[model samples]
Target: MSEQIEDRNVARAGRLDTATLSDAMDRLGIVGQCRAIKPRDAGFRMAGRAFTILYGPAASPPGTVGDFIDDVPPGHVIVLDNGGRTDATVWGDIMTEIAHRRGIAGTVIDGINRDVHLCLSLGYPVFSRDNWMRTGKDRVQVEATNVPVNIGDVRVAPSDILRGDADGLVSIPRGHEERILAAAEEIEAAENAIRKAVAGGMRLDEARAQYRYHQLQTRAEGAKP
Candidate 1:
């Protein structure tokens, strides 16, 4: 996708919540939900295209954790795949501060991060398995960047859109994001109509029936996304 188009999608994602997007994905038979990747703060939220990093056990006389941050484009999310290791953290206070200052959207780790307080204080969104103080300095090394990586059992490729909210994070495959956004918007509008109907003295069941609530997230076909 062009940079301009990606920017538009990211902005659109910022307006929608994860739950609604998940429902859209469900209707579309798409799988992009990142399991176990909870937000560090319930109030935290993020939306951006991914800049993925793949990690592995360090090598003998391990290479320096590459200075990848400086190259990350502003408004892009830093996606770290650490094999879900919690013993050593790949992110910390310094990283959080830098990311916030650099205009980076957020960070999501399949593993753990450090400096929870800093992230919370900066209001910088971070979705990870957990937080710890132990550094991954010599324990893990970057195996690759901008490559496909497994996050919460979901394969997230570079440039994929990810959104996180109080509930959790979900990756929207780049190839299907536009359609997903359209579907989500449609579902959200129907839900709003349902709410308005309920408030206007309509029976709850009738309101739901009018908007087809039960079938809103149900797909007409078993075709996979």
Candidate 2:
């Protein structure tokens, strides 16, 4: 996508309501769930600017991450694309400390991460495929930051809103931000009505029908009059 389109997507993501955001995530079927590596137990609060970190044997040369940090805005997330490798860690204690000191929001790795004790103690949010003790030396290197990278079968550009917690991570595309949020809001409203109906002694199936779930499906399917 064009940079302009990407920028607009980011702008829309900035306006997402937290509740609706969560709802959208729940409705979607595992679109952007960050693999393993539970987030710190400090409660789920979205932070981070926007940075994409890529790590792999085919990754770019060394010092790429440093250049990325110097270029990207502060509070950005470091999205690591390690080709889904869980053997070598892309980010560890030292990188975590450096990223935190740089005011970055968090790190999202498509590979594994290490130094769990230090990462947890330091309270830096991390989403990864696995947790390992082996470090990325000549095995993998920082390809680039703030560049386009693929994570979980999706192409993630810079500035995408990445929200994570004990549940997992959700990577929102820049373009679909507003539409997804709107759909999520509507879904929540429909679910709330159903919730109230069930509390009023309505049967589950009856409440669902009354809420027009079938009608919504028909409309979604472009049913004829």
Candidate with best TM-score = 1
Candidate 2 C-alpha lDDT tens digits along 1-225:
675655555444445544455556545432444445345444534544357877657344433323355555656777888899877777788877877787677787887888888767777787777788986775776766568888766677777777666666667766556655566667667878988999999999999998975443223333222
- In model 2, which runs have C-alpha deviations exceeding 4 angstroms? 1-49, 58-72, 213-225
Instruction: Give the 10-residue window scoring lowest on summed lDDT in candidate 2.
Output: 216-225
Off by over 4 Å in 1: none
Q: What is the TM-score of each predicted model, taking all chains together?
A: 0.97, 0.72
lDDT (Cα atoms) of all candidates against the true structure: 0.93, 0.65
Task: Record all residue pairs in model 1 with backbone atoms less than 3 Å apart, i.e. clashing.
Answer: none
Total residue pair clashes for candidate 1: 0
